[model samples]
Target chain A: MLNLIANENMKIYRRMRTWILVILIVAIVLLTGILMKTHEAPPSSNWRTALQAQTTQLQQELTQVQGKHVFMPARATAGMEIQIKKNQYEISHNIAPAQYTAWSFTSTIEQRAIGVLLTVFVAIVAGDIVAGEFSSGTIKLLLTRPQTRARILLSKYVATLIFAVFMMAVTIVASLVIGGVLYGFANASQTYVYMDASGHVQQMGMIPYIFTNYAFNSVSMLMTVTIAFMISTIFRSSAIAIAISILSLFIGNTLVAVLSSYSWDKYILFANTDLSQYVFNGPLISGMTMTFSIIVLVVYFIVMNGLSWFLFKKRDVALT
Target chain B: MADQIAVQIRNLTKRVGNKTIVDGLSFDIPKGEVFGFLGPNGAGKTTTIRMMVGLISISEGQVLVQGIDVEKNFSQAMQHVGCIVENPELYKFLSGYQNLKHMARMSPGTMDARIDEVVKLVGLQNRIHDKVKTYSLGMRQRLGLAQALLHQPSVLILDEPTNGLDPAGIRELRDNLRRLAREEGMAVIVSSHLLSEMELMCDRIAVIAQGKLVSVQTLSDLMSGGERHVITSFEVGDKALALSILNRLFKDHVVDDDNHPHLISLKIDKERIPDAIQALVEGGVRVYGVSAVTKTLEETFLEMTGDGIIA
Candidate 1:
């Protein structure tokens, strides 16, 4: 089984396309860093006075909106109140609004790159791993071996997952290096502030925040990769598999939002993909808990992989 | 004797939609023999080969490789088998050596030394390190064969192995396949529409047409028309007189030879050649030469398949 996985990895890494994806990630990170550097706001040394002035201005806005009849006035006032409390917390704790440091840049890159680019890249690789063999007519060579079909499919699945992890690592390492070089690397111990699920201000170290973000994003990445793999195994055309996976990736969140009014919408895949919402913000739909989403995700994971294994192990491979 | 049978296919059938592609075909390929599958296009030769190697699903019946059921115990059955479905479509982006290595890893117990040996066996040592996209069709064919032979399987099955090879490449493949069967005692099953190539390479040939088995005979028996009469042509100086004499002796046995005035042909038994020659000589017809023209595999195949298109 290990030998088969090595073969799968060889097939993936030996191609120039796989390496191009890594290089593309690094290049995009560098470009993003350069752009962020040029547009960065200058650091304020008098941040304490600035925080007090912002609190006073927010208080004025809060009073003006208090008696007004507007759409979502309560929600607007709640957001303003959270901002005032955060400013007060920073002033009392002597934690200035974060400056543009290497850790901050890494955090920023993680937010943008992991959500959009990394998922799409991993989806492309997973989508092609099985379908590529069929389209190229190499499936015959691959299947006419001593290994069972189940083992072969499992090897491919494991290899694709390893590839996703490797790509995420590359994204992280590249962003850190670029962010460190462009911005100063002095704020490794900085704290990130956010409103927790209970609407209370919470603070954590910068490094732990980045890791938490990755851990949350990885859940979605796992689902996306499995979807791509299932599609790849079921369909013989790599183009169709890749296009469908990417299409679903871009539209999953939108689909959840469009259907969020229905009670059953919470059971959808996208609703459960972003587990971080349970930790930082509230869930998309009311009554959704961390346990519920995890259950939904596990069910989806099993069904998708089960269908893949059933179809792959039984379907006849015709001449392509 | 039963132990010598490398592959036993019984009632092997394939049906797609409402049509049957292969209908209850049964055959046994023993060890140390080069077996040929002869059929026209869409005649189920490729389908049968695919079923034998467990590439396509078997609709009915079963394929047994060295006593292992192919569909039931696929991995064990496949361990004794190596096959190329059609064109040896390999990874064009990978070097020939890398492609071989990829296959060797899937098939356990195949060492690096075995890979090198198969490379040298296929005469691809010089270009083995080059990417397959740079190889010609013939070289890719050899690499495909090397990949199949890497495991040293006792049963080697190839579907149209000579699809895109030059004359020299075809001869080289034929010689190598024959040598593998002879020296290593492997059962090499080859399928092709080229009757001449099959005649030269196969020890026994199984002919099929329109999903039905037409005939299965040894190469010599198939060529000689098995117990049937042969077309014997006699070159004579006096064609009209020779025809008249041959007609008077055996009217139904004489064949028309008007196309060539110097030739008189007969479809006759081998034992009566002396009687015809004596009658021709006594009737003042000078016979220059006499020759028995045995039927080639082409004629025999055409007769069996009712002149189906070879392609």
Candidate 2:
């Protein structure tokens, strides 16, 4: 099994396409950093004064909305309150109003670059892992090995997952190096501030924050890979698999938002894909918990993989 | 013992929707012999080979490789078998050596030494490091053969093994398959629609048409065992006299042919050719030429299958 996976890895990494993906990630990271650096809102030396002024304005707004009959949304009020609290906390702790650093830049890339571009790149890899073999007519050579069809499928799946992790690591390292070189490498132990699920502002280290974001984001990434893989197995065309997967990945959130009024929307895969909602903000739909979303994601994962295994094993390889 | 049999295909059948692709194919390939599966286009030759290698599912019956049932225990059965289904599709993005190494990893116990041995066996040592996309069809075929022989399987099966080879390449493949079967005691099964190639490569040939087995015979038996009739053509003088003389002496043996004026065609056994010639000479008919017509396998295949379905 290990050797099979190694074979898959060799096939993956030896191709110029895979290297091109890596280069794209690095280039995108550098371009984004260069763009950000050139945009120059020079670092404010009076950050404390700015924080105090922001806090005062937020307080005035809170007081005005407290007794007024003006129709303000409750969620908007809560968001303002959280922002004021985070500002006050930063001021009291003298955290200097989120200064630019290598750690922070890496964190930003994790949010912006890894969120969309990484998913698309990983989707391309996962999508092509199985269907590409069929398209090239090498599936005959692959399936006729002594290993069973199930084992071969498993190996490909595992190899795609390894590639996803490897790409994630590459993006992380690239973003950090570019970020550190452009912005200073100082503040390696910076603190990040955010609101918890209990409506209180909290602080965490920069490294942990990035990793926690990745951990939470990986739930959605996992689903994307599996969905692409399932489509890859079902169809013999890599373009179809990749296009549908990317389309769904971008459309999933919009789909959830469009249907958020429906009570059953909580059961949708996109709604549960963002497990961080349960950890920090809350579920997309009210009354959905972390356990429920985990269960939903697990079921989707199992069903997708089950269908892949069934189709891969039972369907005849009649490619002419 | 049952170990002498390399592959036992018993009542193997394949059905797609309402149509049968390969029906009730049963044959045992013994060790140290080259077996041929010959058929016309759309004759289920590829489908049958696919089923034997577990590429396609067997609808009704089973295939056993070295006495192990394929459908029951596919991996174990496949361990004893190595096959190339159709045109040897390799990883074109990878070098030929990398392709072989990739395949060698799948079949456990295939060492680097074994890979090198098979590379040398297929005579691909010089170009083995080049990418397959740069290879000609014949080179790819050799690499495909090398991949199949890497693990030293007891049974080696190739479908349309001579599809894209030049004459020399085809001859080399034939010699390699023959030597592998003879020296290593491996059972080599090759399928082709090219009858003459099969004639030179296979020890026994199984002919099928439209999913039905037509005949299975040894090469010699298929060529000369059953029929002794040779159509003898005689170029003679005095067409009327020669025809009359031939008809009088060999009444039922003479063919009513009018393609030539002085030529007489007779379907006669070999032993009676001298008597007919002497009788014609004594009857004052000059015999200029006497030649026996031979039937090629193409003619025999068309006769057996009875149509224009050959590729």
Candidate 3:
């Protein structure tokens, strides 16, 4: 199994596609730095002044909307209040939101759409994990080796998951380093502050919060990649796997939104994908809990993997 | 009860949908020799090979590679065998050396020395570091052979090994297979429509037509019909007189050549071409050409299969 996984890793690393993905991610990180730098107008060294200005602007906007009926949710008002309080506390303690802080970096990952980039790149590998062999006709050579079908398929799945973990690590490390280099590393040790759904301010260790962000974001990633892998083993064409996997990634979010109005939406794969909902986003469905979603996800993972292995093992790889 | 057989395919069969691709075929290949599978297009040669290599599932029966049942214990059976089905499929994105290295990882005991040996054997020394996408078809075929030989498998299976090879490449491969069989004593099974190449490469040949085994025999028996003679056809007028004269002269060797119904052809000694013409001429049959026919493996294959190469 280790040998097979090693072979798979070599195959993936030697391909231009993998390099392209790595380079693309690095380029995105660099581009984010440039855009952030150029977009920050009248750059201020003192974050206190910046925070005071932001608080005044938000408060002004809030007061103007008070006399007029607005469509904004009550949570938005609560979130704004928490943001103002957090900024005031930072200012009082002479704490500045350094341009390159790890907390800011986490926000960059979410705000600058790095998750989408990471997902697309990792999805490509997951989608191609099995089906690409058939499309390229190389599976014949692979299967002819002294390895069982289940072992080979397991190796591919492991390799893909390994790649996913590597990509996630790269994302966090790259963002923090690049954001630090471009702005200031002073905020690296600052705790991450955020507003939970209940309008409460939550604080956590910087490194732990970044890791938490990674873990939470990866819940959807893990599910999508598993789905992609399942599709890959079932279909011999890599194109179909890639197309459907990517399509479902975007479509899944919309589906969850459309279906969340229903009570049974909790049973859906997408509804369970955002595991961060337990601590961060809050559950989409009323009765859904972190453990409940975890169960749904585990069941899907097992069933999909079981299906892939069974089909791959029993398959008659006739021509392609 | 085991013999010195490298591969034993017992009552093998493959069926897809309503059609039986390979039907109840059985054959054994002895060690230290090259075995050939001769069939036209759509013949079950590739299907059988796929089954043997465990690329495709065996529909019925079993293939034993070095006495290990292929279906029941596939990894063990495959450990003794190395194969390439249809065209040599490889990771074109990787360099030849990397490709070989990757394959070596899968097959245990394929050390650097063994890789170098196979590389030299296939004559791919210089371009081994280049990506496979840059290789010509013949180069890829050689690389494929190098990969198969890396593990020192007891049996090597190739499907249409010389499909896109140049004349020199084909000759080079023939020499390599012969040397491997002689030096390493590995059993080689190759399937091809290239009858002449197969004849030059294999000691024994199995003919398959429409998924059924047609005949299996040594090269000499297949070509010369168990006699040390060449089959020759003489185009002549007075077909009845020529056929009768040839029948009487050559005895059991004389048969109506299905290839040319208008002329009578017979298996005769090459040196006796003049005697045949003289007999035909004296028998009042006008001989147009008294040429000694090339008793090519082509003739034997067509006769055995009873069908043309549709694909």
Indicate which candidate wins on TM-score: 2
lDDT per residue as tens, model 3, B62-86 = 9998889988888888888888787
Compared with the true structure, all predictions reach lDDT values of 0.87, 0.87, 0.82
How high is the TM-score of chain A in each model? 0.89, 0.90, 0.87
Model 1 agreement with the true structure over A1-320: per-residue lDDT tens digits: 99999999998999999999999998999998888778867658898999999999988887777656334445456677778977876787565675466887888888975557898888888889899988888889878898888998899989988998898789888888998898777757777767777665577888999889988988998998888878888877788888988888889989999997787898889889999998886777868899999999999999999998998888888766
DockQ of each: 0.81, 0.82, 0.75
Which parts of model 3 are misplaced by more than 4 Å?
A43-77, A95-102, A197-199, B226-296, B308-311
For model 1, the stretches where C-alpha displacement exceeds 4 angstroms are A41-48, A59-78, A81-98, B309-311
**Interface RMSD (Å), every candidate:** 0.9, 0.8, 1.0
Give the per-residue lDDT of model 3 (tens digit) for A1-320: 78889998998887888988888787888787778777766536766777999989877766766756555676777677667776776776566654445457656665466887787788899898799888888888788998778888889988988898888877777777787777666655566667664546677767787777677778778777888888888887677888888898888878988987777877889888887777764667766788898999999999998988888988878764
Clashing residue pairs in candidate 3, if any?
none
Clashes per model (N, Cα, C within 3 A): 0, 0, 0
- The 10 consecutive residues of candidate 3 chain B with the worst lDDT sum are B302-311
In lDDT terms, how accurate is model 2? 0.87
Residue range B79-137, candidate 2, lDDT tens digits: 88888888887999999999999998999888999988988888888998998999988
The regions of model 2 sitting more than 4 angstroms off are A44-48, A63-74, A85-99, B237-240, B260-262, B308-311
On residues A52-108, what C-alpha lDDT tens digit does candidate 2 reach at each position? 898899888878888794567666777887788778766765556545678989999
Q: What is the C-alpha RMSD of each candidate to the true structure, in Å?
A: 2.8, 2.5, 4.7
